[model samples]
Target: MAGTKTIDADVAIVGCGVAGLYCALNLPHALRVVLLAKTTVDECDSMLAQGGICVLHDPDDYESFFEDTLRAGHYENRLESVDMMIRASRPIIDDLIKRGVRFARTATGELDYTREGAHSRPRIVYHEDITGEEITTHLLACVRELPNATVFENTCMTDILEGFDADGRRVCRGIVAEDAGGAHLQVNADATVLATGGVGGLYKHSTNYPCLTGDGCRVAAEHGVLLEHMDFVQIHPTTLWTQKPGRSFLISESARGEGAILLNDAHERFCDELQPRDVVSGNILREMRREGAEHVWLSFERVPREELEHHFTHICEQCREEGYDIFSEPIPVVPAQHYFMGGIHVNSDSETTLPHLFAAGETCCNGVHGRNRLASNSLLEGLVFAQRAADKIMRDRFAADTAAQLAVAASERSRFVAGSRDVTDVALLCGAE
Candidate 1:
């Protein structure tokens, strides 16, 4: 028991963020699933996302949303991936609502949609400013209620488990993991998913959880999984600037979407606040350079006091704690490493080149973001593709692959015990929600 333990599951998913949770939720109840987390689920970069999740609120708006996404990515986006995400947007939003997720509603009781940078119109649904929290928390709860799933916080993948099928091809078996007590584990499964999030922790300053060190891509590269756009890191244009260390606090892009503006040290508005993220971040850097200032300003003067209080409760509290009253004055802001648009390459169905292996969320680049990611699209892209990955698993994992499947079982039969951890219940969130 002290050495490497063996875990047998129908599917093993790494990373317990939205992608991981949603993937678990979508899988069939008959399948035993194991979800591994680097830390408690709340620390995921998905929880730090403050802006919102994009959707196709209007049928005619499809063209607008598509064009906006393309323009933001500088037309480097794969047309098929972008089209699939946009087409799948509303259904994903609807699915979240049915899963006990709470979204902000207007006076008429209709779901409220807001605008963000690079968005042509207000089509992003949110829950105040903690949209990611609301969405992922409920999804985590849904995942927790599944009797077939076990979530292991403090467990993380050190590397993927690999074995050859009857065809003599290298296939992903599952992941080699470490538990909270530092015991190695071989989690063998019929299908394996890498939902291990982003590369933000690699930078000295980022808005992501410190654990997101791009482990998924690193291991995927080790297995020679096709990767794309490894250099396409995204930096958000606005984060509350402080000399203090720790994760950078993001000032939601919706702040600008709701009419907040970025200002120079001289109190002059320098760039259009609602431009694509990369464009605005570049602008802020140039302005800071010209003025020899450490940081620029973000003025919420145009935003109503009531709106600030209601829409950005967390932001207001954090700024006040930092000695800035955002309701009356501007907050010092700077660009910081935020999202990774590049990742392990996948297709429209979230399938990587490797057999029985898949990737979703920030760890996998499906070319929807191209060279740059538009605001609030990360959550949508993650959910849409993750669900598709699950669907692909459900549809194809057990179909016409018996020779390879039997080969995988035979290869690992000495160590793997089917459903070895299936009846063992693992806690989720640990009351952090």
Candidate 2:
């Protein structure tokens, strides 16, 4: 048995992925922040997102992007949340760039945009095929440099510590966690944020980190926190197929967006490669069932070899290591559990029903992605809502601090008046004497 440990912070952020890191980053340096990671800080599913993050690009791109998202989500998305995410997209991307994210650029040095499935236009920005890694790593680096932030790796959040606030409202006191050495950890904080990624680890095969088993949602559920769309999981249309599986390697949807196509056993195109993920995945599954095939093929023959070498270096190297030469042959692909659209229910401000508790990323359902997620929207949504959660926390904390200061000032004023009266009365007594 190991000893118990307790720590305190102004804010405790669970999961050190993009959401957690960004949340911590957006917080002021005066506030103490504690970040917990299930494994290494870089092990979250956000690091595996190969496609670029979506952006609104320009003013004219708004309506089309909005409509495309609605259509992809089957109108199950909350309009306000969708609008918030889309409207915030440009600023979020700018923030990433300011944080030293090296997105792909054109010859003229302007940001290069690419199209993805379900997008009405080319609105996604990338750093080759590993955009997630690029963005997440940079954000992680920034968080690491913060003087008020502390990071705990190899720590798993077993559950959230619950209690009642001064007002008798249910609130979270932070989390009860277990570290790599089996030590019990109790992190008490004024605010607790759950950014524990997604639930793909529970699946037999998925394009998510095996550690991401919905810890936030599970803990929130156990504590009676409001959750939305618990069943709204999104299946990615394409991952590199393999029999010896651990984590599924996602074949970037941008591949299809660029020029790649899906072919059946008879080497005939079956599904429109540019449709929404659910539609494309369903078509691929139907094709496989019709032919009794284990997996279909993703062919990049139409994509120039130079483009492949430059844009998909990571994927190409991975395929080559797996004994498949993508340059000369089509690599096998299948659909796998990808993103979760439903999670801990949150309002537009990213506040959960429970006081002082919040969730972001794939762990929270803000209803932006609706029933099915459009390609490349996951990163944007995570970043957008994570900052919103941080902003809300800051706002509440500031208000509380201001009220406390005002109360103290009022008490001081009353005491001063009483003391002055006492002094005046003593002087009057002396005069009477």
Give stretches of model 2 more than 4 Å off.
Answer: 418-433
Error of 1 at 16 (Å): 0.7
Q: Give the TM-score of candidate 1.
A: 0.92
Cα-based lDDT for every prediction: 0.90, 0.91
lDDT of 2 by residue, 57-168 (tens): 8999999999999999999999999999999999999999999999999999999998989888999999999999999999999988999999999999998878887578
- Number of clashes in model 1? 0
What is the per-residue lDDT of model 1 for residues 1-433, given as tens digits with 9 covering 90 to 100? 3688898999999988899899998899999999999888788988877889999988999999999999999999999999999999999999999988889899999998899998989999998899999998999989889999988888878888788975798888888988788889888998899999999999998988889999999999988899999999999999999989999999999999999999997899989998999999999999999999999999999998888988999999999999999988999999999999999999999989998899999999999999999898899999989999999998875664675677776766533444245333212212222
Error of 1 at 62 (Å): 0.7
Q: How far off is residue 368 in model 1, in Å? A: 0.7
- State residue 378's C-alpha deviation in candidate 2, in Å: 0.7
